[model samples]
Target chain A: MKPVIEIESISKKFLIPASSQGYQTLRESLTSLDFLRKKREFWALRDISFSMEQGETMGVIGNNGAGKTTLLKILSRITKPTSGKGRINARVASLLEVGTGFHPELTGRENIYLNGVILGLKKREIDRHFDEIVEFAGVKEFLNTPIKHYSTGMWARLAFSVAAHLDPEILLVDEVLSVGDAEFQKKSLVKMNDLSKNGRTVIFVSHNLAAVRQLCSRCMLISQGEITSIGNVNDVITEYTSFRDGDSPGTTDLTLISERKGSGIVRLTRIELRNSDEQVKGTFLMRDDLHIHLWLEAPVKVRNVKIVVDILNSFGETITSMFDSDSGFGLIEVEGSEHISITINDIRFYPGKYNISVSVISQILNHKYESFDEIENAITFDVENQLVNRNLTRRTGLLFLTPDWQIHKD
Target chain B: MAGYEIKPSGWLTFDFRELWHFRELFLFMTWRDIKVKYKQTFLGLAWVVLQPLALMAIFTVIWLKVMKPAELDIPYPLFAYSGLVFWGLFSSGISGAGESMISNANIIKKIYFPRIIIPASAALTALFDFVVTLFLLVLLILYYQIDVSLPRFAGLFSLSIMITMAASFGIGLIVSAATIRYRDFRYVMPFFLQAFFFVSPVVYPLALLSSDSLRIVLSLNPLAGAVTLARAAITGNPANWQAIFPGTLMTVFLLVAGLTLFRRNESSYSDLL
Candidate 1:
């Protein structure tokens, strides 16, 4: 298939505040607009290049400020690039955010025509598909009502329906799929999947890795305005997870997270997660052998040093907790500073991004010495379905396991 | 469905062919603006008539009844209403185009279009209001039994004058561009229009200011010529060509300059906004 969209080394720069304090006054704004101070140059995207075939769906994955949206804006022609150039052979439709193309005062019926025109659809084509569009949006009854009165869900559903129905050859969708309810999200997913299958070039950007994995045949991992990796969806995701997990400040960079008395006696020196190869790894699959290692220094000999590993999700919900001394429950002693290694085999977990918190504690909190050195979002892991038996089906919950099933005809 | 090719610097070069493709959209948006304006309002199109008529009444009292400036041999209401129609056209056109970018900020930031069409369409919308008020002026002319002289054809000159002043309203396009970057343009526009209203021949006829010294200065304001031409058309009188000609020239000059500024600034709009 011929490439429908070819992006050639495009970059976008923005002038953001060097100090992001509030601009509360017009005088302050005008002074800043004077341009001798306050503003700093930000390269939102830098020399990004990619090409997509007519029918390929490419997922763009990145953290916040990773230029995913900037690339999309440049491709969709909503904003001009600061440098370089890009070309697309077919029509482009973009839903960068929910309700981007909607006019609040206009009725849904009027908006359909307006949005359709915006998306490069002819009036007669919208007229022909008017019923289908309303039905798809599930706002058939309220089509005549001004959109301001519609619920956000109703607005999103109708806006997305108009955008999705345009049948544009190239579609750039940001993370706005998570706008409506779960059922609507599922329906939208199905629609996007269908669009991908139909061979229209699609560029999907979202924080939901599962959706990217499901719909995108290829993906790119961007970080700090550059493409760190690009290839198959799984490979790019693996690289991204590994990169993020590695760059997270470990126990070594504890000054930012250090909580200590003015005495300055004991401090966290380092932390390590050694797999079977003695190499640091935060990534783990379901039922994988895992190990935790730590090296610290103390002025005096410490006893009853217990290590607690708490896994937290992105929202700070603790998913699981494990105490190092719970199983072996031994009083270990360390002089000055010494490297300590702890191993746990058969780590059972789900497929998702997770955070690890490490705390050094004494079994008896009766005048405990060293406290929790803050390590936040320490690691993330993905669990894949690895089944050995043909009869075992892949399960859908946090932990994928074989469930006994019985089928009956009713 | 194909995307329009954008030149790096040329924003006002009208792609007539491309605009023609979206002609339906232009027409629909124009109609939608009109419908939404009159919808649910008790007066409906009467609001259009009321605006100029009310302004005419107030100006008549203030300029003629209160000040008793100059007789001008015509009824004050007719004179003020004539100027009010063109004044409404010019003022509303600029305000409409100035607010055009902000009001449609959602659509402007989302999709790509000939951004010029926005202000242009707003000017056209004010044209509708102007037409409705013009009908009222014709009724006034019949009631007064004004003579329709051969020079009345000079009123067609006012149509050209109306377009030129409307082009002058295209100055809002420049303001729209400025607003995208520094939103200070939004706060400054209403005050600018209000202050400009006093200088233009809206409240009083330009013919009333018959001083040889003040005539040139008043003629410099483009709306002065437009209002005078409009007054001549409705009241069946000779238009003051000396004032009207210079004002028309200024209108064309302001319009071309505004278009150039808007075109140069349009590309950076999305980035700044």
Candidate 2:
């Protein structure tokens, strides 16, 4: 079977300026235009390709500003791509935004006909399905009233019903379905599922991972304007989640964006905190081992240096302190560059925001303890209380690790 | 519904058959515009008649009573009102259509339909008002005891002239396309319309100009000859078939050129808007 939408080597490029702020001015605006031209280049979608067959439901998951909407707009024929080509062999319908084709002074009944024509439906076809469309919208009572008189929810309902009932062969849904209430959202999802079950192709774009997992049989992960992974829904979502968490603020490329400070003699070049499975994380359970991997660079030789990990709460209060020298942990001499690993097992912190403060000290001769460099609130994370059993129980205190439970019923 | 024949040639071509297929949509859009225009209007359709009537009264008083340069023994009100009807159709239709895309930018961005329907329907809405004023012209002409050549065919002849003037103003297509990106045209169009209203012989007759140079310059404006001929049609004067023929040809040329340019820019309107 041939793919219903054959998108081959489809790359969309945009001429976006480095400084694209829409400013209204004279001299500064001219200067900014000069700056824009100097730092602008073609932002290519980059050697990418994808195709989908009929009845296939594919979900596109990506970060913000990752060209997901641009790809969808090109497929919808709302905008032409700067390069590459694609073909769609289906009656495509799109609901990128609500209240799109509505006239303010026109009634709901009038707008439905107007939108029907906009969607390429003939007058006879609209008349045939008119009643069903109106009934689905739930605005039958306000059918003849001007749309401006209707509330926002009523407008959204009518807009959704018109696009939904049109029943195009392919549906391109953007993140606009979240406008309605939960019940309507459920109805719309059911409508989409029904469309897919009836051998219609659906391309859904959304940020909600759970919805994508529940609805899409195949999903693609987009990162930095490139398709990173595709295929099995679970594997793709897992890869996406890892990609998102691994790029969290303090974990990714800390050398250029580290919150720590140091003299030029030695600096915190890199840091990675991972779980037991070797997966980098920014969020963790309260009792998990907070294994920290640090890469430090020293310009000159240093000996007998101590490291400290300070845990602070959301209000900047230092809750606990774990010092390497205090625990009598042995330290080796470093000449230029060295790696250090610190594992604090069974962390017992309350449910709130916390940061790690790393410090280095020296035990040198003729001097007691000399401070090398100290940093505050470098890594931040959130903790959630463990909800083990729901027996209407309220457990107190931060430490609930390795709970000992016994029950006897005779 | 999905399959369509892609044009073999890369250049765009007019699809008159597709337009005919969507005739119902055109009619519906025109009806919607007409309804919303006078929905809560206090005077309703009477405002249409009152607009040209008031303009004729002012022109009659100012040009006849105040200026009184040269008269060919014609009723001042009839001459001025006739010119007002044709001029109103041209100015109001074109200007209304010129602002249609920007004013209705919401509808333009979302849907994929023949974008020409927007400006075309706006032009038609103004045409409806022009028709109401034509009814007043009929009453005024008969009341004034003006003689006509075959009064039965007078209305049909006037409609042909009115439509010609409307087509002349079909330059709105070009204006609408340009206004999407520049937006400077929106500010300039009203003053341009005002200047055109005077230069088109709406307030004065063609005979008022004694110089050959001025008459030749005025004839170059499509509406100047058309309006003069339409006035001659109602007043039983010898219709200047010479001037009317060339004027009609120019109006059609403008209409065709305007629509062609508009179609070229229609597909990219969303990006520019």
Interface DockQ of each model: 0.21, 0.15
**Candidate 2 deviant stretches above 4 angstroms:** A16-48, A223-225, A244-281, A287-410, B4-10, B72-74, B149-169, B245-249
lDDT of 2 at B92: 78
lDDT of 2 by residue, A162-257 (tens): 777768888888876568887777778888889999999999987656677778879987765678888988888666543224357436444553
User: Please, what is the whole-model Cα lDDT of each candidate in the order they appear?
Assistant: 0.70, 0.71
Each candidate's fnat? 0.30, 0.21
**What is the C-alpha lDDT profile of model 1 across B1-273, one tens digit per residue?**
464432134435766786787677676667767877887788799999998888888887787557968766568888777777777888888878887777876776777676777777777788888788878987887788887564554555456456545555657666766666656677888899889888777777666665977878888787887777766665556666776788777777778777887777777666655
Docking class of 2: incorrect
Winning model by lDDT: 2
lDDT for A234 (candidate 2): 82
Question: Candidate 2's residue-wise lDDT over B128-210, tens digit each?
Answer: 88888888887887898777666634664565566554564467887887777557678888999899887877777777788
lDDT of candidate 1 over A1-410, digit per residue (tens): 65677777888887766654322234656766646675778888888888888888999987655788777777776777878776788887787765555677789998898778776678889989999999988898898999999997898888878777768778888887767888877888898999888878889998677788889999998877888888899888766555243244222344433222222233456666657766666566556666666666667777666667776543234667777767675538656876667776765555555556666666646555454243433445444435343222225434444469999999
